[model samples]
Target: MEIKESTLDRVKRLKEKYALIGQDIDSYLDGLIYANPLTYWDYIEVDSLLSLQKPKTDFPDEKIFIVYHQITELYFSLISHELEQICKNGKNISDAGQDLGWKDNLDVNFFIERLKRVNKYFEALTRSFDIMRFGMEKEQFTKFRMSLLSASGFQTASYRYIEIASTDLKNLVHESKREELWNADYHEQLDNIYWRRGAVVADTGEKTLTLRDFENKYLADFHRFADEYQPINIWKKYQELSAEDQKNPLLIQRLRELDINVNVNWPLVHYRTAVHYMGGAAGDEKGTGGTNWKKYLPPRFQRRIFYPELWSETEIEEWGKSWVEEVLAESLKTEEKLKDEL
Candidate 1:
């Protein structure tokens, strides 16, 4: 015997079941908070965090910059939350009073996985930088550079959070301070927004690096490794370092063999953009926008580093002469050897 319920009756039963499940979920969430009420704010704050963008420029590209930065900050907040949670977990497991059933060694594995996600965000973030640079040709940047009088990305609280986090990890942090003539109500609004979200503005050190310094570091590394064996090796070293328990002496040697490692990609991207957007060798001097722009390096730092032997003027000339003579001799020998073999 088979019994089929009417459509209305079935729909009514489905609704009743969903309502029961919803109540059960709410009850579980409440129990979770009751277990650790001190951590309740983490849940509340996550929801209220990301609504803080106020664009003030009509320069269509400005919104792209603002949104990319906002998205980056949101990722940073997630990273900070994960780091804090991992640290707490580590401390909890080691504490004598509470026997956290979780294995202490597993905490390290969890942290590494969390950090790998952060690195993926960073990879995307650097690409965002590339996209922003693409948006601003020299002239477009100049148009807004003056408007930016005192304002810069370095001043952003999100960037400051990155700086502070880097400092905490014992990395050499550069601090720079430059006075700007312009200030905006948006700046005040940013402060107010932080308070509204119940988060404090990050205390960042002054900007210690200039555009020239940034260029020099990239250029120097590019020059140092322009004629290296392969760029892929550097990429490999970066992957090794990112792993949960990676330890290999060969990778370390490879890292030293390639001076810049992962950072080499940024300079490479910049050069590629110049070559594509600014036009090849001929258009180097002519600004992509209206402002004057320099030619991307003839071969570029990365190329030079990857192919150092080719760049040596004295060696190149000698090698060119010897190569021709050797090729001719080898051709003659090949004919003679073929005849003898026959």
Candidate 2:
């Protein structure tokens, strides 16, 4: 049989590639011959993924709860991946979860493209959050929620990482302490991060078990990523661009959208879901993890703006104002009736 020119070229390139390291292409070919064919199910690990929904209760909605949360974490990972790629400027990123040093490849177009992608992720999440809103039976969920104990969605590490990688550590600080820690160091800033207060005891002013476990698992990681990304976070990278490049309208719009998607829309959806299930809006139902979701999930309360500079003084001040009012108006009627009955 006559060999095609393309095949010959490929073999020649393969020989050169292997020869660079004093390796044999034939040995690699031999290994491939013995290797089993990759199946789609195996490659995607569908079985393992399907096995993950080990609900603590017999409720069918509990499975939906588990699967939806897993999907959210996957998206969070993708967001972090894009942020890391931007920070590192597409440098060698084969080492999973390892910091790729910045490459100074600040292309405004690249920034817009990645920001667009992150915005799309949040949009999909915001829309699909209805699954949590209306998919689960309230009766089934409230019952299964008891089975969950301290394992609340508040404990996820990926979302926290996204927040850290998105902006200055000062922005992540609780609003009340943000001024006090304005120029504080990483440790000080991390100590006052707003989300830490999300899962605190409402009365005793102590960490909940969920927050404690979360801190034990990821506090060091948070410290490391906060320090590593501080000088090159998305906002910092935006500032690193040329003055004219920073003026790109699409970049500004995408960033503002990102700020809303992450801070307002995302939390607003959770706020809706929590209100539906938790006897929320001036009630005493804490999250399964004892997270202060009433205060934490409401964007108006959290008021976490990633790109505060992109917004006007009034826009920043009124951040999440309309949504809070809209939801509060609706929530108050039902919750107030419930309060009166209680």
Candidate 3:
């Protein structure tokens, strides 16, 4: 068959492209002739993805729990991806423990766009958490959870990476110790990241097995990632922008939204959901032998603000305070109804 003029023109351009790399265009064309057409199923690995839910127990709801967490981590990975892109163009920390070179190809619009994407992911996760909250029978959840041993959603590394990539290391220190640890050494700062507060033994101060395992696996990587992004984290990059760009209303709005999304809304959803599933014991149900989710998951308790300078004093003080009260009131009502039924 005669080749169409359009096809000949395309092939001519393709030959030039391969000639630049000194490759035989005809050889590549021959391979394409023998290649199978791609299918959506093979590309997405649908069968392998569906087979991932190997629930440890026969409890049907356990599969829901497993799949939901997998989806959440996937979202966390997306959030981290955007953050890494934002920081990629900025100067990295050096062996001297400070970013030395001045290099930034960052666009303010790019910053806002990526932060908006991160906010959307968090918003979607918050909305979908109801799936986990109401998806399982409380009887089944409570029973199946025991089979999980020290495993807990609190061990999510991508979520921790989100926090580390969002701001300076000092901001993640527990509020009560922020001032004391703000000037502390790097290892000390890592040791005091606020999440550790939730993983301590209640009576004797010791890390829970879940927290220990997490630290063993992730603590080194966390330090390296934090150091690499120290000079270019979202908050630090925001600080380094020109005063005019810093004052951009939309930019500020996106940053503040990110702060609230990660620090307040995300934790609050887990708090309320824990109340629904674990009931009053949710307060006591922190990762095994730890301070409990109530202590860790409540924004009012941690008061961990990322962009503190962006918020007014009153806004910072009242942050997550009202939401805590509302959730507690709802929890009380839930407990009363359970008592009445019993």
Candidate 4:
């Protein structure tokens, strides 16, 4: 039997098969081009991306500065989006644990996937910062430094929120109050199960993981997932993982590297922006970008940063030590006063 092709029939066929046919055709063309790579030069949307450079100054390097910041902001957008998903995934996983591991297979996979996506975001953000650093020069940056008045890296809205979230998670997880912890949906779920039900150690006393530890976990999980997709490893437990075992060592290493890269690079960018472009850091008499440059940080953050491991102990000691010192000094003064009176 011959099939009649009318306007409706043709339209229906196109709708059903267009995407599949397009994908197949594109794959075939891509493979052919790869076999003979000279046939097609890689094309990118340069006009849209490059047109984004809106330099505030006529400085020759202003375009580079603008583009670099733009790129970093774009990466920030991705990072923030991935973080939101991870928050959701974490909430789901923790909530499932509260339910006694009643999570569906899909939920577990989805959570893992969210983590992988977040790690990828870190990688992208780090690389973007590295590129931005390249465009900045020691001398040229100094000229435009004053132009960046009342602006600072710390003022980035998303960065500040994420930073707050990171700290808040640790605070809620440690607090004895269930309601306090539950305020953050993801942490709340984790707290309900692990802390409330006592499934996990309430105090690893480990408190928050170090940047190094965070990196290791990200890399390990990424590698584990990649083994199924893109396997890589080194023989005999090298930093990089091999496809041999399901365990991904390299991915774990990559996570650490990426984490360190991001943590270190962010501060470096701020420093560079200040020193090179913003007047050698001395010109900021009034604090850049609404940041309280002169404000004394809370003692807790200082202790956690300077002596990270002894943060809790240092805080405890600092609290009591001052009063004890004062009491001893006062006693000595009293003794001296008595001796004089006698």
RMSD vs true structure, all candidates: 18.0, 9.3, 9.9, 20.3
lDDT of every model, 2 decimals: 0.39, 0.82, 0.81, 0.41
Q: How many backbone overlaps does candidate 1 show?
A: 17
lDDT of 2 at 37: 90
Off by over 4 Å in 3: 1-9, 16-22, 90-104, 185-187, 281-287, 323-342
How many steric overlaps are in each model, in order?
17, 0, 2, 16
lDDT of 2 by residue, 33-142 (tens): 99999999999999998888888888988989999999999999889989987876666434443345644476787788898899889889999999999999998988
Candidate 4 residue-wise lDDT, 221-304, digit = tens: 432332322211111112122334223333333333333333343444444434344333565533332233322122221121
Show pairs that collide, candidate 2.
none
TM-scores of the models, in the given order?
0.37, 0.88, 0.84, 0.42
What is the Cα-based TM-score of model 1? 0.37
lDDT of 3 by residue, 1-342 (tens): 999999999999889877877889999999999999999999999999999989989999999999999999999999998898788753355444444563457778888788889988998998899998788899998889888888888789988889888988788997878999988875678778888777777666677888889889999999898778776788888877789999876677778778877888888888888888765453455445454655567788888888889877877888886643453354446546656876
Instruction: Give the winner by lDDT.
Output: 2
| Candidate with the larger lDDT of 1 and 2 | 2
TM-score of 4: 0.42
TM-score comparison, 2 vs 4, better candidate: 2
